[model samples]
Target: MSKQISEITSHEIKVEGKSSVNQKSSVNNDLSVFADGWAIDTAVPLDLKKSADKDYHPVLKAFLAGSFSGTFSTILFQPLDLVKTRLQNPSHHVVAATVNRVQPGMITIFANIVRQEQIAGLWRGMVPSIARCVPGVGLYFSSLHWLKAKLGKTRNQDLGPLEAVMLGVVARTMSGVALIPITVIKTRYESGVYKYNSLGGALKAIYKAEGLRGLSCGLGPTLARDAPFSGLYLMFYTQAKQSVPKEWMQSPSAASVIHFSCGIMAGIAASLATNPADVLKTKMQLYPDKFPNAFSAALYVQQTYGFRGYFKGAVPRMLRRTLMAAMAWTVFEEITRSIGLK
Candidate 1:
């Protein structure tokens, strides 16, 4: 009887050991699957993991998409940009042919450029504009992507409106600082301040004339303008997208339309909020010697053009920014989606 009891106990111990080994093996297999980027989670489905999430070169893809979008939008809206720049330039006094002094409208400025500098002159700073925007937008998108990835903590990896604002502010601030030199060149090229025949010549001339400071003339105002603009735009855009019905987002065409509409609304709000900073940035970049800082530039605008001076190019700027941003984001989303990126 004692021997039978001993045999049963030994059998039980062997079974339990085998079960423990199987359990450890199962855990090891699960860990391996997770390391291979496939995880079994209760909240997020396995198939819902996008190709973009698995992509090794996400930042590079983002940059190319952003560059393509920026190029298309910048070229399409170059005329509006030129008009806005001309309107804001303190040097260009738009005196009417008649005896009365009046603030020139976009039509007046557009007509003047066509009449005096020819139709081609409407694209005055095309080279510099492309230079600044292509890479600038690329940098912005890539950095924005990186930030979202780093900061996102939700199961779906989504950002709230406030988080979106923070991401946009940080991303745009980095891009703005890195591209301010090109921005200054583009502004000068548009302002008709420098007479260089080529982009290279213009860059060389500016560097020689004012050194490094010349390249970064409007850094402060540029940051002030771009950071808040991007922050507010992203916040508004995110909220608008969330407000959209899930049914509407199912169709690609409907989604595109929704994105564009949301972008325009967001751009309008952000542009209005940041127009004063933009005006200051342009003024300081165009005449760095006269207005060395944002404060001085503010004073100059207030004294010269009064309360409305801060919004000198508001009309053309609003139009250009609204349309350009809408188009850029639309194109960017399409391209990224096509390339299997989210």
Candidate 2:
């Protein structure tokens, strides 16, 4: 009887020991999971106590989608933009003519241009716009996030308004370098004949008439205009994000409203910032024969048309940009939310 009791006691000890080891293994597994799950979450790093933040990527996804947004928007509103340009530009005839009883809006102007130039005219500058906008959009968002993250790392917190604005300027400047040549293409194509028409025609005309430099017509004006406008856009977007309450970060229309608000501000700021460049871009594109480079064109505009030349088609530009931003951000947020991705 004593031997039987002894055996039972030994068996009980083995069972307890096994249970202890199992519990320890479970704890270790849980720790491993915590490590894997939270390691890459940008918001909450695995080791929040530790000081390592992540670097942002090339942001290709944002660029591709955003370009689609830009392209579609342009297609939808090309006519409006055309009319706006015409109103602002006003050939000697347009100026004297605009003052008369009849004036054309977007639809009418688009139809008129098409009637004269054909359907392809509506898509003028498309190639250059696409080329410039793709890289530009990618660089802008990626830089913005990278800068914002870097700045936020100072406090190990999220982006604040000031940091956001500075980041925007950096991103926009990067995009501007790529945008110059493309701007020339779009300008020439939109300007009409003698200068150029289609993308191919514009390239040849620019090549034969003025050489490669002619393609960089409004680069300086574009930079000057883009910087402040970009700064304002980032500032406004940052401000809008902050305005939303913490709980509403994931909310539907709330994000939309914030984005729209930011878009409105960006549109206004960009319109004001770029009015001069827009006129110069249009004039240089159309009248490349007269002014070859951006500097010469700007000087001519300032000297010939005075300050007013700087802001010829401010109205339509402002409206189109505002619409673009509003639509882009709203769709961006909405799509991300629906897909459980952001």
**TM-scores, one per candidate:** 0.82, 0.69
Deviation (Å) of 299 in candidate 2: 4.4
**Alpha-carbon lDDT of model 1:** 0.87
- Candidate 1: tens digits of C-alpha lDDT, residues 236-279: 98899889887997889998999999999999999999999999
Off by over 4 Å in 1: 1-56, 90-93, 96-99, 153-156
- How far does residue 104 in candidate 1 sit from its true spot (Å)? 1.4
The global C-alpha lDDT for each of the candidates, from Candidate 1 onward, is 0.87, 0.64
Number of residue pairs clashing in candidate 2, backbone atoms closer than 3 angstroms, sequence gap of 3 or more or interchain:
1
- C-alpha positional error of residue 162 in candidate 2 after TM-score superposition, expressed in Å: 3.3
**CA RMSD of each candidate after superposition:** 7.7, 8.5
- Where is model 1 poorest over a 10-residue stretch in terms of lDDT? 90-99
Residue-level error in angstroms, candidate 1, position 45 = 32
lDDT of 2 at 169: 71
Say which candidate scores most in TM-score. 1
